[model samples]
Target: MKVAVLYEINKPLVIEEVTLPPLKYGQVLVKLKTSGLCHKQLEEMTGKRGHDPFLPHLLGHEGAGIVKDIGPGVSFVNKGDHVVLGWMKGKGINSEPPEYTNGRNKLNAGWITTFNEYGIYSENRVTSIKKEMPFDVACLLGCAVTTGYGVVNRIAKMESRKKVAVFGIGGIGLNVVQWASVRGATHVIAVDLRNDKLELARRIGATHVINAGNEHAVDAVRTITDGGADYVFEAAGNIHVMEQAYEATNGKGLTVLMGVPKKEDKLCIDPIPLYLGRRITGCHGGDTVKDEDIPLAVDLYLQGKLKLNELITERIHLSGINEAFQRMKEGKIVGRSIIEFERSSPD
Candidate 1:
């Protein structure tokens, strides 16, 4: 199989043909149809979280594919089933991460990876959805849509008419704003420095939009919410934005951190807000229980409720991945981009 290998941090991934080992217990082999390009992968690629001992590893975590084969212990999915591959654990068996090789050098991969023609993923990381679901958009359910839905439903438990301020309208942030609206938040505010993203957010159901580039996000949010928002989500992964999100939360509201910050980065906050009933915390994939939540997200999409189609701003071949990353760094991607492998026809 041909896979993009991360040889070093802040370096272009080397596309190489490597031998995929036979599936082990609790593992399954999948022929990837599409993969979602996530900022989390960008963080990993740039070594944002610090030293990576797992160099020369596979590069993606969210994808949709077909079950080409199943190992001995696999039971949830059968051959030819359509499934979503995600980093979060689901109902199946949890096997060890897979390893591939070029006959000389060993390559590492996590439980799930999709930036390749084929992948050997743990059964627990694969969830079978309807066979007819489109692979390209279904890829979003693996992370973006699921995380945002989980954030609104599970983490914040945000009720209708609550004020919500999402501090980044990218893939996850856009979903957060969309779900916030779907959940009936009367004052759903989308915050970003980019006008295109803010405009997209409005179409996605944000009652208000704030450009932090020109004005103060905290002040804008406060003014819109009449003091502060009930829920403030920091999805931009910026420490300064996180602090602002914290400051923008109502005295008795919840602030959820949806973006992954640098490992050495820290944010200062006053505990007095907590004393007054304010709560601040972080999210792990929006605390999504994939087995239950993924299906729900899929249902919403199938019912023409979730805006999965609009989230895909670009569809690039795997060879153009580095350029995609550059676009992401420049904030050129409005929502999310998908790596459509069919066009590449990798060996």
Candidate 2:
């Protein structure tokens, strides 16, 4: 199979043909149809989240595909089953990570990887979805959509008519806006430096938007909320923006940190806010239970209650992966960038 290999940090991924090892127990072989590019992958590429111990490894965590085969002890899905592959664990065996080999060297891969024509995913990382779900949109269910909705519904437990602010209107942030609006938040304020993203956010239920590049984000959010929003979500993966998101929240409201910052970066905030009922917490893939959440998310999309197609701003092939990352870095993509795969023989 052809896969993108990250041989070193702060370098472009090398696309090469690799030989896949046999599927181990609880693993499933999948022919990927679509893969969603995420900021997390960019973080890993740039070493923004710190050391890269797993160099020369496969990249990507969110994808949709058809089950081509399953290894021993796997029961959650079957051959021909349409599934969403994610990083979050669901209800299956936690299999060992797969190893792939180029002609001369070994390459590493996690339980879930999608930046390839084919992938061997752990049972817990694959969730079977309806055959009718579009691969491009369904792939987003693997992380972006599930994580965004989870942050609002599961993590924050945001109530109706509450004020909400989301910093960074990328894929995850865009979902946060839509979900917050769905939850009946009176004010869904989207903040970002990119006007395109901010505009897309407004189209997808963001009641207002603030271009942080133009105006002060925290002050603008506070002003729009008539003080501070009841809930604030930071998805920019920047330490400074995280601080701003925290400061933009109401004294008694919650601040959910959805972005992963550099490993060495430390967040500084006033301790006095804690004493006054202000709460802050970090999110892990939106606290999503993939088995439960993926299906429900698909149902919502099928019912037209969710906006999946709108989140897709660009689509490209695996060969264009590096340029996709460049666009992400330049803030050129308004929402999600999907990597559509062509069917290939799993040699």
Candidate 3:
């Protein structure tokens, strides 16, 4: 199979032919149809996220594909089923409960993330896709969409008539805006440096848009929501934006940090506000329970209530993966950019 290999930090991924290992117990081999480019891939390429994985490792995280084969003991899905690559691989209902914890009981299951081609991104990756969806849409259900929806519905627990603010009007942020609006937020503020993105944010559901570059984001969000928003979500990984998100919330408002920040990056804030009942929480994979959420998102998409089509900005061939990353770095694309694969062999 042909996979895009990351040869070195700060270098372009090299596409190379490689042999895939046979599926193991409880694993399903999926013939990938589409994969989305995410900022984490960029961070991995530049070593911003820390040590690199194995040299020449396949690069891709968000993906969707068709099941080609199933290994022993796998019965969640069957061959020929269409599915999205899930990020939390090992941390599902089948996982084991943790033996020990600080105080509260917790599961020891490992998170399922799609970072490698077969692991997370590739023509054929390990997955258990449902039979009822398109590969392209299913792939997004793995990360971007799920993450955004998770922040709004799970972390913030947004309620009707509440004021909400979403910083960074990119893929995840746009979903946050739409979900908040759908939840009946009376005032939804979208903040971004780009006018084009702000426009898209409004079209999706933002009651107001703030150009973070032209005006102070914290002040702008405050102005829109009176004193402060009931909930604020920071989807941009930048530290400055994270601080702005914190400032945009009221004294007791909830701030959800959904973006993955660089390793070793520290956030500095006063102790007083934190003591004032304000809450800052972090979420992983949108706290998604795949068995529950993925199907719900799929149903929402099928109902036309969620705007999956509008989220997709472009579709490129698998060979165009590098170009897609370049465009993403240049901030020339919006929402999501997918790599659609064309089969080279029937087998």
Candidate 4:
């Protein structure tokens, strides 16, 4: 199978033929249909974040495909079922004793992301693919969409009539805007520097849009929501924007940091404001439980509450991934750039 291999940090991904190991217990083999490019992939590729930093590593995490083979003891899905890949591919966390809360187990600690094509980004992928929806859309449930939704629904505890502002109307941020709207936010403000993204945000459900380039984003958000929003989400991963998000919140409001920032970077905030009930929180993978959240996200997509199709801006072949990454860096694309793999015809 042909998979894009990351040989080193800040280097181009090399598409090469590689061998895939047979499926292990509790795993399945998927013939990938499409996978999305996430900012996390770029971060991992550039060594901005400490991940699988070694060379010759597969590097995709948002994937969806058809089930071609199944490993022993797995029965949740069957062969030929259309499914989306879960982000954490490793074993789920054991929900017992100190882990379980209110009669529910905690999320799993799986490592099955969609970065690898076969292993992470190959023509063939090895993992458990849960069958339910179209592979292309399902792939997004693995990461971008899930992350945004998880932040809003799970982390922030958003309620009706709250004023919400989502910074960075890109892939994950866009989802944040729509989810905020769907969850009954009275004033949903979408903030971005790009007009195209802001327009897309309104189309999805943002009641108001702010171009951070035109005015001070913090001021704009404060004016729109009348002194600040109830919840401010920092999804751009930019330190400056993150600080602005903190400042744009109402006194005692909550700010959720969803973007992955540089390890060494830091943001300065007024300690006094926090004492007045202001809360700042950081989350990982949107605090999602894949087994439960993935299905719920899928159902939302089917119900027209979640906008998945509109989030996909580009679809390219497996070989075109490098160019896709280049476009992403240039901010030439919005939402997600998905890679569609063509299956090899039988001889």
Using TM-score as the measure, the top candidate is 1
* Candidate 4 per-residue lDDT over residues 1-347, each given as its tens digit: 66676767788986666555555555566677788888878877778777652444566767777677766556666677676665553333321111111122121112344444543211222334435466777788777777777789899988888999999887778988988988999999999889999988988899999988898889989989889999999988889888999999999799998777877999988778899989999887677666677778877877778777878878888788888898998989877788777635311
- Is 2 or 4 the stronger prediction by TM-score? 2
lDDT (0-100) at residue 131 of candidate 4?
Answer: 52
Per-candidate Cα lDDT values, in order, are 0.90, 0.90, 0.71, 0.73
**Cα RMSD, model 2:** 3.0
Q: List ranges where model 3 is wrong by over 4 Å.
A: 90-132, 260-276, 343-347
The root-mean-square deviation over C-alpha atoms between each candidate and the true structure, in angstroms, is 2.3, 3.0, 7.7, 7.9
Clashing pairs in 3: 32-123, 63-139, 87-112, 87-113, 88-112, 89-112, 114-120, 116-121, 117-121
Candidate 2: residue pairs that collide: none
TM-score of each: 0.92, 0.91, 0.83, 0.84
* Model 2 residue 276 lDDT score: 95
Better of 1 and 3 by TM-score: 1
Clashing pairs in 1: none
Off by over 4 Å in 4: 50-53, 89-132, 343-347
Could you tell me the lDDT of residue 187 within candidate 1?
95
Instruction: Name the lDDT value of residue 306 in candidate 1.
Output: 75
Instruction: Tally clashes: model 4.
Output: 22
Tens-place lDDT per residue, model 3, 1-347, is 55666768888876555554555555566667778888778877888777854554555667777677766666666777777775555322232211212132221112232322333122222345446667766778777777777778887777788999999887788988988987889999999989999988887789999998899889878888888998999988888888889888899899998777877889987658889888888776577566566778888778777767667778877677778888888888877887777635321
TM-score, predicted candidate 3 vs. hidden true structure: 0.83
- For model 1, residues 1-347, the per-residue Cα lDDT tens digits are 77898999999888889997988999999999999999889989999867999888897889999999999899999999999999888998999888999887899998988899899999999999987678989998888788888999999998888999999887889999999988989899999988999999998799999999999999999999999999999998899999999999999999999888878998998889899899998987788899998888788878888777878889988888888988998878887889988884521
Candidate 4 is scored at a TM of 0.84
